[model samples]
Target: MPNLKHLLLLSCLGLSPACIDVPPLEDPPKEDPADPDADFTFTATPAQEQVLPGGTLDCDVRLAWADTTGGAVTWSLVSPPAGIELQPFTLPKGETRATLSIRLGAGTEPGAYTLTLQGKSGTVTKQATVSVTVGKAGDLVVNWVVPTPGKAYTRGPLLLQFTVEGGAAEQVEILKDTTVLVKPTGSPYSFTWDTTSEAEGTYQLSIRATRGGAVFTSAPRTVIVDRTAPTVASFLPAKDAVTVGVRDSIQVTFSEPMNPLSVTEAAVGLKTGAGDAIAKSVALSADGQTLTVTPLSDLTAPSTVQVDLTAAAGALTDLAGNGVASAPAWSFSVPTWLPMGGAVSAVGGATSTESVVLKLDHDDRPILAWAESDGSSKNIYVSRWNGESWFMLGAPLSGFSAIGTNAATPTLAIDTAGEPVVAWGETTGNGDERTVFVRRWTGTTWESLPSPTPPSSLDTLFNPSLTITSDNTINLFTSLYDTAGYSIICYQHSNQAASWQQPWELHDDPYLFNPGAPVSTTSGGNIFVAATVFDDHTSKRNIAVYKGKEPYLGGTTLGNSSTTPSIGADSNGRPWVAWSEFDSAPQSDGQIFWARWEGSSWTAPVAVNTRATGNSTPSLALAKGGPHVLTWSGIIDSERSILVSQWSANSWQTMNAPLNALSAAGTPATAPSVALNSTAQPFVAWTEADASAASIYVVRINR
Candidate 1:
């Protein structure tokens, strides 16, 4: 440092003179080109361009400006034209670079436009030319494909598809011809057309595909909306009453064509004889007309069944809209009982010219008949009454081989159930013993009663009589003889419990003579057995009727003397007896006699018919609450014939006129058996020779 005073003066003089000479300190010496120290050179890339007419383009403007102060840069739009919008612009940090994007309005005119970009350093402008036109809407193309051509599908759902190309579709109309199926709004148009609602027919489908304010319809494609025709196949259980559960369906057969909806509206109904509709559930077949219904409950047999349909109801309708003219109702009957009818026969030959006689129950109709043939077994014959005519049951068991040799005449009686039963004897053994066989009819089945014993001794069971009581009990009576004599009367009883009582000897006598067939009748629980018993010499037969404890019931002989007394009892327990008496010797002709039993004894024999010839083999059948009909075979001239008479209005009416030829012929109709059915009409089973085969036959009396 210089000395304090003098050095200070020198330092001030130097500093002051220099400072004055600097000329106000001209800013640091300028470089060669005037202001070289200041920032100047910079450039922006791809800044200006022109766009084509109606064409779209994008422009990115980059900015570069030098800063004299050396700082960062940013850009912004300074001038924007009308209908123009500024896009995003960015700038770099600590540098002078910036970018901007500009868009022109759609309606801008074709002219030059300037883009002004302002940065931190300064603002710049870029010019562009644009040729503007107009915007265009998108186009649409539609197409369709038909899957099935002319084929008819079942009545149900159908599917279809549509295709659209070019621009995105806004709406799609799928039409079956002029009929619109689906009108939908969507992009990439496609649709399914359901033809379930359409009838069976060929159709054309057109798809109208629309897009972006433009619409186009595709060419119509031929499509068939076919449906199967309805049909009823067949009925069930076609023959008779069909038993089905409540849920079962009743099917009706249809030929063709049906509407399912219409069939649903029709009602299937069931009914009884009273015309009441049976409550049931009903349904229509898939194709319709065939209605299926179930009854609410089960039905009983022996009833009339009816299925009804109403005209107002749509039972079945075709595509033509033609319905059933009238609802058809079907009816059938349920069977109550099985059928039962067959032949009636006796198992023996007519050894004697005789009338076949049978008795019927109170509830049955009566049939009187007879049998006739030569004494030899071969010619045994039969004839009968047919409701409207006379016919035969069948040929008799006549020849020795047919009957196992030597068969006796037939005897008949009405069984417990009002059916006829027959019994007879067959001689097979060499010693003259006979087998007695029996059989009866019970409407549905034929029942055979077991013989009491096998044919045994020479003096065998003969002249067997059968009588069925009201309680379903059957009693049989026959003469039992030993080598000594024809003594005791043997009795057999059906106990009414499906079994028979043991045989017992009824009367004991050394010479009991011939005992006629027993006839029994009921008054409440009391049974009366009546018969004709011959005297010791077998000359005079006595009419006898018994009451109480039968077989052992105490009874007295009624009429003094009458041969072949045929006896019966009416519904009120009053007895009537008829017989024939020989006029002269034992070999002579006979006459008819009648008597009535009044509780204690018979009224006495009265002449019934008087003729020059013989009147014999008198048979009597008393109806429970009706008439007593009588039959007999008489000999007129040299001929043997048969006649019938009925007791009516306290007098006998001769039924012989219609049968006069037979009654007055050489060979009379004989072996007459009578039976009645529920209607109280007589049915006769007899043997006659006038017919072919000389067979056994049946005939129903007109009265």
Candidate 2:
């Protein structure tokens, strides 16, 4: 028997001694010493457990003997719950421990259950009980599928996946924030998220899993959906720029940030006019929006450069894995300007010359026409360059049978078959009556056009200007003096017509005199004539432009005190005029001025000559688009020299030096004529006079 203090200590130690019954202190039935009482106690550790419906609980059952000999113990479960399984095992001899395993089926119900365990050794038996509270399975778990976590998707199909654990799920849904994206079916719990229709932005993604009565949600994951294709916002040296610097770098700006790793040298290119690739290095800006291409060496002058950006699959890409929608391409030109070359004598002899006309053939060869004489009657001559020297085209054009007969004011044009056609004013008898005549070189001799009898209304005709249209129609413009007044007339001659068309009066104003009526044909076969007309109101000879025939569309007055106006038409049928005009006051000499017809009206006149004096006979020619090349005669350093200038980049740029010699001791160059070839290279011709003799000289650039 234990004292009250001992009982209290035993209870505090978790051992209750009150459960054990103590017999009175008396004599007991004695047994054989060899057959001592055999007894064992069955117990379980952790007698109470909390679990879910589809969970298992494991416990250990042990048997101990009071006698010295020990035997194996057989274990069994008593009154277990339905659908509950227990693993049965026998404890081996001399072993004091054994393991017990309990498993519940997935379809098991929730309830409070008591499981009994029994162990037997020979004829001795022991029993223990374990209390378990079975409830529903824990909440379902969801996880990411394809794009693990913290990943962005482009504007295309995106696959999402989630795995459910702990229990079978009846329904699963993928959500973006609070909005339901899709309700998926089938196994593996996956959905293909098509993000092509969504806008570019950031979104929170999560999964909702539901069973019979329980619902679970996964933590939100940040996802970025970007579907925008990069674009080229701007380019450095704008497209079709004609005056790009040789050392300029090509630059491109993007609409968004780009991937640095995707920008490589293979993604950009620079090429020459001849389609040859140039060496270049590519670099991306720090912000990844600007890309620059620097050529390893200086670019070629007077050449065109092409810039290209690659649109290949992996060539260029944005940070969100999007590529450029289309490749960007453009071309710019470096101006081709060279210093003037030395002047070369084209035709020189002991002969004096009058007016001269210069024109370039399709191959850039110079063709010249002039009226020359050897102290006698003047004769018309036509010559062309053979790349080395000049050669006469045919015999003398003026076949006069009487003395003192002369040919003057020669104008030249090239026909469709590249043959020289000349028109001149010829004195018919004893240099008294003058008439206009035309001749074409037929590779053998000069073939004269049918001469029409002069109408009785005109007295004399001079200043013949000629233009050949695309259809081989010969258009002639001449200044005439009649009994009424001095007038300008035009005549048309075609291969199909038996004779020249009747001359029509363009301007019949008596105040107009010395009308330098030059004719030019536009690409649309429309004729344009520029002349100097006297304005009675201002009492000045102002330059005027006339278009078409009879009821002329345009006869607008241009510069003041202007003369020797030359007209040319560009590809767009717009007219450009150049002439010589004297300064308003203080300055006494004439200067070269030019203007263009801008569809609605004429632009203000712009002076081209920078020299101080002697600017006359301005000739204008246009290139493919609208660039103007003007040449005129101006005196520099007290000597007459041929000056040249060009309209470029919205302003006129004069050449550094004169085209011919300006030495005071040398011949004076005058009456300059300028023409451009197919490539826009200029060729200039002028007559230099020395003593009583004059010679024709031509000059051009090396390129």
Best by lDDT: 2
Per-residue C-alpha lDDT of model 2 across residues 1-703, encoded as one tens digit per residue: 1123223323333121101111112112233234333566766743114455555565656555564544677787887778787777788766776657677777777766787887877777778987665656565545443343334444566556555556678988888879999888865665666677888887888888888867777656666677777888898889998656667889899897676667777888789988899999877786678888899887886689998776433467776668888777889987544323233333346777768898887677788899887456678888888876777888777746566668888989888878888999898774456888899888778888875445673467777888888898888888776655556778889988878999886754544554555555555677888777776646888887777563332445778887788888887888888888876564448888888888778888988749648688887888885357788888778778788788887877886567554244567888888888887777777887776577777766434
Q: Name the top TM-score candidate.
A: 2
Q: TM-scores across all candidates?
A: 0.42, 0.50
Give the clash count for each candidate: 59, 0
Give the per-residue lDDT of model 1 (tens digit) for 547-624: 534432223454445656666667777767776667477635577778776665556567765453667767677775
Which runs of model 2 end up more than 4 angstroms from their true locations? 1-349, 507-521, 550-555, 583-588, 661-666
Q: Candidate 1 versus the native: TM-score?
A: 0.42
| Model 1 regions more than 4 Å off | 1-355, 359-403, 417-420, 440-448, 454-459, 487-490, 493-499, 507-524, 536-539, 548-561, 585-588, 610-612, 635-640, 656-667, 675-687, 690-700
